[model samples]
Target: MSLVSAVQVRCPSCNTPFTAQMHRAIDATKEPRLKELLIQGRFNLAQCPQCGVQSALSAPFIYHDASKSLFYCFMPMNMGGSAIQQQQQIGQLTNQFVSSLPPEERKGYMLQPKLYLTMQSLIDDILAADGITKEHIEAIKQRAALLQDIAQSQSVEELERKVKESQDKIDDLFFQTLDDYIAQAQEENDLETAQGLSALRDEISLLTRPEGEIAQQAKQLAAEREEMLDKVINERDQERLRTLISEGRPLMDYSFFLALADRIETAQASGNEIEARRLTKLRDTVLAMIDEQDEAARQSLMQAAEFLRTVIREQNPEQYLRENADRIDDAFFAVLNANIIEAQRRKDENAMKALAAIGTVAASILEEKAPPEVRLLNRVMRTEPEQRRALLQEERALLDDRFVALVDQMISQLPEENADLAGELRQLRDMAIDVRAQG
Candidate 1:
């Protein structure tokens, strides 16, 4: 079963309200296509019909790969809460995920899921599990950053200087990144940026006509790009085409489109007008999809910014938060966290304190909304390590079946790495059982 829900969103651009479907959990084994989206960094993406803007919601979700015995609970670090509160939230999500599984398939690893504080780290580990090395991933990241720097050069001279200085760093990944962005720019009708990137590519190609190992990798990348283009050309299903565009986004660059246009021309010259028309239609559809994704990315960022502005402008941010608590979701926290980090970078103490206050309030609200048992568990966990026993004893009246069951479930699934927490949960469960026996 797909774990998705309809979320109401107000477009930051047009202020038009709409419903967006978001997935709460991903079972990659069942939905391999979704796994592709996650890998392509397009999962949980939403587009506004009103303004045609796409937004990537930074929502909390669980990822399970039964094949690899991988289970991860990703709670955005920006969700702002104490360690105890965060654990309680994670516990709830973990329990829900476990309950969703069939009894036979449910394993001990499912219960003690690995916790990821950030989406990128989670993605990196997922790739690592798939045999992608950290060093390779880091190199790709550096190349991407370098590409951005080259693109942002204020003048031709500056761009040329940067290109020459970073010639050694440029490789297949760098060209792939450049090609991807150029394709995006063309899709969005930013001809200037597209042309600029094309010119930069020409210069880089001349400087490093790669040979041997580098040349072999470049040839492989080109072949993969051609394969992706063929998939788009032959796909008959609209949905599948969309998926292809998303999964092969990196390959859908200037060269891919050029190759596609060449095919269309060849079909037309060969008097295969029907084939030519079909290819043209495919091109149009791809362009539209790219535009929608670009808009979504823009709008999502704008929504986060607008939400932050609203919170910061209010005299009573907490009260505002209380009234509009639904808006303080993962995406909101992501934006807030980024701002807090930027403020810290700038050494703006006041801004950090203000942002931190909002986080504290958000945590408090989350704790307040938790089930009574969960709230009690949070309190117990929050109590001083040495004094928790006394606290639990004093509040023994609260130790009912629900509390005992929760404790037991936690103890059963607790990872060996978390020996301290496992011991604490065991103590709680034992004391709760003893209290019930006495009655």
Candidate 2:
């Protein structure tokens, strides 16, 4: 009997090398189908001995100078019409399956199966370029066929079975081919190719290892994104509150009360029951101020109102503080009295005494011999329209200059950087000069 020379190839899975014997002559009677299948590049599950990964290898039927051969020639003219016919048949079947899905679902459905097939095709392309042995090629073909079956299966059970079978075949083919390729490399002294193939096998093995670092990075990114979103939400809420205050929303003008409510709501939302309860008590204190009808209590409420107005105007300078300037002036004077009361409550004796002295001096002057201009100025300064027109000519004359002087003093006392107040005071001074000229 003649000795059969074995064909060897490298295994992709375990980096082992193995060999399979090449048949010298086709056994037409004993296994006719086997001969045909070998020519057509078809095989069943063949696993790697090292890792049990499945694979398939089959040689393509070719003709060389009127003699049947297992390998195809490089020249296009040497290729038989039968090879082209088989390729076309496979393409048609693939197209038919893809076209069967609905338009909307088609892309997603095809994508999943296509990914597996694409990976397998990449492996085949790499092996084919390396000029792997017939046994390795046949093993790859069997693995590809099994992967195709897995992709096409609709039911989970069918898919699982196909996957297991394909894995088994892949193991057998990869281990056997790897063993043969390593042996061949040693024999031929191709150290570089051996190292490269070994690295590829090692990379495949790493796929089963836990990707803890990757998972941790993903979680960190997610948390950062969530924190950024929360910050944006809080900024939006504060902007809404500012807008409401600037718009002179009636309920929002009570800053102490509104702030209390805001704190309570925020605390509750954050699940801080203790903080929410404390804020609720603060809200009740503000409500009590509004409930009292006495002059002292009303003055306290007015100070809170003026403080709210100041806050709104300062925060949103572009917004108009008052539609009616005269009404605003009267309101300002009324709120001053409230400020004194608030200052007294806080034991601000200096502020209260200073305001009281000013009030006393003004009252004393009213009792003295008043000029017409001074009286008229006093009338104009009054909060009520009836009081303004009740002024005698002599009283108007006497009070006008004093009123201008008072306004100048108040303007000088304001913060130097208060541009809005400075501008308004300048206009008031001009108006006073115009009134004096008319007198």
Across 183-212, the per-residue lDDT of candidate 1 in tens digits comes to 545434454576568777875775566457
Per-residue C-alpha lDDT of model 2 across residues 1-439, encoded as one tens digit per residue: 1112356745678878766443322222233333333333432224467776756533221111111112121112223467666466334433443454346523432322211122234334434444766576776666545544544666646654554454546475554444444433422334445444454444333322246854674466456544433332244354453443333222322333444466679999999998788667644543443343234434544554554355334544223333222223333444445445544533446656655654444344443445554455445555253333334333445435667786687678887589786676566556666645667
Candidate 1, residue 171: the lDDT equals 76
Q: What are the per-model C-alpha RMSD values against the true structure?
A: 25.1, 35.6
What is the clash tally of candidate 1?
Answer: 6
Output the number of the TM-score-best candidate: 1
Cα error of candidate 2 at position 205, Å: 78
lDDT of each: 0.79, 0.45
